[model samples]
Target: MRATFHLKTLTVAIAAFSVASAASAAGLDRSGQDVTAFLQDGLYAEAVYTYIDGDVSGHDNAYIGPDKKAYEQGKKIDDIAESYDFFRYGVKADINDTFSVGILYDEPFGAAADYSGDNNFVARGDLDASVNAISGGKASSAADAGLKIGQLTAGATQAGAAAANFAAQAQTATTPQAAAGFAEQAQAAQTQAQTLAGQAQSLGAAVAAARAEAATTGEGTNVEVRTESVTGILGMKLGENKNFQVYGGPVMQQVQADVALRGIAYGPATGYTTHISSDQDYGWLAGVSYSKPEIALLAALTYRSEIDHSLNIDETYPLVAALGGDPVQGNKIDITTPKSVNFDFQTGVNQTTLATAKVRWVPWTDFAIVPPLYNEVSKRSTGDDKGLPLVSYDEDQWLVELGLAKRLSPALAVTGTVGWDSGAGDPVTSLGPIEGYYSAGLGAKYNLTENWAVSAGGKYLWFGDAQGQIPTKTIVSDFDSNDGYALGVKVSYQAK
Candidate 1:
């Protein structure tokens, strides 16, 4: 009975840790590369599904321009993230005591959000000429100030024509008093023309300045990221007791994303949307594992290399072309996903209990997405020759999880976990608002038969307070008093 309980606790902790560990990681981390599932002893297969629900709300939020002033005020941006689901599957087989192979399918990274709500932050621009921006320009809320500026020019032209006609009548006057009156009228009309011309020049300058400033202000965005990957693994056992194993293989990944921007703060990005897709990107993973059956100790360290992709991207923004900006833009971009390292270990504390811990590091600071044309416009407008990224990370991330598992019966096991993430940076982009999280989880595993078992787990995450910033490093929004949770279930089967 004692041995059976220890085995049950260890097995259940390994099975449930995948979902619990991922619930607190950084960036679009979904599966946490749960290679442990692929390292099972024999012919093993498992499928797991996870659902995450998050709610974010904040106040006193506004987009600050490069001039260090509020460019626009925003209402509460709430319910930005809806519920999302993820699925993972893996199968492993042991050809012999010293050889094993496996394959896994999972979504390693992803992000989703819908900004359609009562706030104008994410809504399409009306391009109203009556609206004024903080930078002092007509139609400042609109990306294309050309239409309004054109109207002003046309009105000035009409005034100039009338003034010329009055001067001609003055030259043909029959009486000195009438001629003097006509000349005065022509002079007033000419003065008015000069005034209008001056106004037009000032308007043009103001509009240009506003456009430049707007490029540096943050805006509301709707972004979705989808990733699918297949990893093939081969493992070899070594040492006299076959206690050490090494594994590595090829990985193929597919990535896609759709991003849309809006709000007065976005300027040229307003009504801009793009679709990016990649079919195949190759990478590799290598790992070493050590196991001691007597003490129920298993330790593994894995490294996943970054994958580079040249992707086809479709860009669209009607206002951009209308405003003399490029709408039909570059078709391809080179992007690379960040690399990561994972170290996981578990040990038997006693006959009935086990302890587990995992630590993950991802060099997110090395990650960035910069569309070509967008970068060009940003460079010209912000006077930053290097340009800015559409999305990026300022710092690396670390996630740590510790847990304990115990078996109450031969068929039932329970585990509890606490997790923490270091977050990629402070004042992250509005696209991914939360900085980091602290999480707690509980899980239970039940065996229906000798070869079949199921486990369910739930985790609650407390998000850290964070501010959203633009390229100018001005605060545009605040995210706080936010929380989220995830629920997952896994079913596993072993061939007898």
Candidate 2:
């Protein structure tokens, strides 16, 4: 007979490494959407807290104009990645040998970033008529001023030409009566020319004054997004020995955000801002699992469906107000969250050792946030009525992690993991300017008693380099050699 080994009582803490994989994920992916807590043996309950922080900084593009009068481009952008954190709680109970139920809560998807320092992302109140800027007689927002200037100049030219023609007719008239009539027309034409010229000068002064007041007061670009989810699950064990199980449940989620677009990098879209009111919606998740206690093995595959939401959004664009429309518009937009697939597997290698692996995929390329007002305003510049969304991803995301756990003592276990995340795209959104990351983590779990335990873990991330692009697919910045970290702690209880 062959000898067999089971690590049910020694290496169960192997799940600890999976808790903080959120430190380096793609496409607004956070929390890793982990469901391992619900898979624990018997009645189990756990609460996990994780924190992430990074310094994402780079240089802004720069170009100076000729004649030494204009200098635009080549400036430094400060750290934009703000400190972020969240919490997760899960409780599971077995009603009998063949049925189980559980509830889980987690903040799954989000982002937070702010641009500061002397960069294009900040709002400047100074507009130079010499330089092509808002109200510089070049940008579309200055259309009214440009048109008025053109009309006044044209009127003055027409009046002067008419005066010259009438004066010549007065000089050559055969009769004094006809000459007086022509002379009167010439004098009136000269007066009209003077009046138009004076008006033209006044209009020019007014445009200069407006340009002086073009500078607005405010901070630079910034964005904050948050989401919350709660899931209720029911599982039924099938077949003899109850080794195979199928489970699924409904998920409730809420999302909200605030955004500000400032500075010259956005061109006419500068000073644009948006607010998304908190919206709650529903979705469903399904999965299947198999286990073999003799070898201490478990494998499961899960799928989460996309949730639909009607988000109420308010937007403000400087150009919209310039184009004779309300600066702020409030409307509702239809948005659907992305769907995902997750696979988890673990098995005991020996009496005191365990091996584990996890893989996750999200179709982010199919996701986009298209605010109606922003899209409509974009049509004038893009010339395509289809317009563009304020935010979107260029690629899907794939994350893979492998881990090992070993029992160090009767009541303690240690775990280690190495992971890789494929970011949403190479040239990602300017808001979150990192492509993805490579990560490594270490964790330990100590059992205090038969029903209680504590686990803590930390991960160090090496972010991948990427180019940041705005909605028009314009590359304005580059972020490279950046890094971040994630830390997590969990308190767990089990009654097996």
TM-score of each: 0.81, 0.83
TM-score of 2: 0.83
Can you give the lDDT of residue 114 in candidate 1?
Answer: 66
Q: Each prediction's Cα lDDT score?
A: 0.73, 0.80
Model 2 stretches astray by more than 4 angstroms? 1-3, 63-73, 129-215
Query: What residue runs in model 1 are displaced by over 4 Å at the alpha carbon?
Result: 1-15, 63-74, 124-131, 134-220, 322-325
Best-fitting candidate, measured by lDDT?
A: 2
For candidate 1, write residues 36-109 as lDDT tens digits: 88666679999989888888666424543344434354677776775788889999999898989999998888
- Give a tens-digit lDDT track for model 2, residues 144-209: 556766787888889889999999999999999999999999999889988777655444533443
As a whole number from 0 to 100, the lDDT of residue 449 in candidate 1 is 85
Clashing pairs in 2: 61-74, 62-73, 62-74, 63-73, 125-215, 125-216, 126-215
Question: What does the lDDT come to for candidate 1?
Answer: 0.73
- Tell me the deviation in Å of residue 167 in model 2: 34
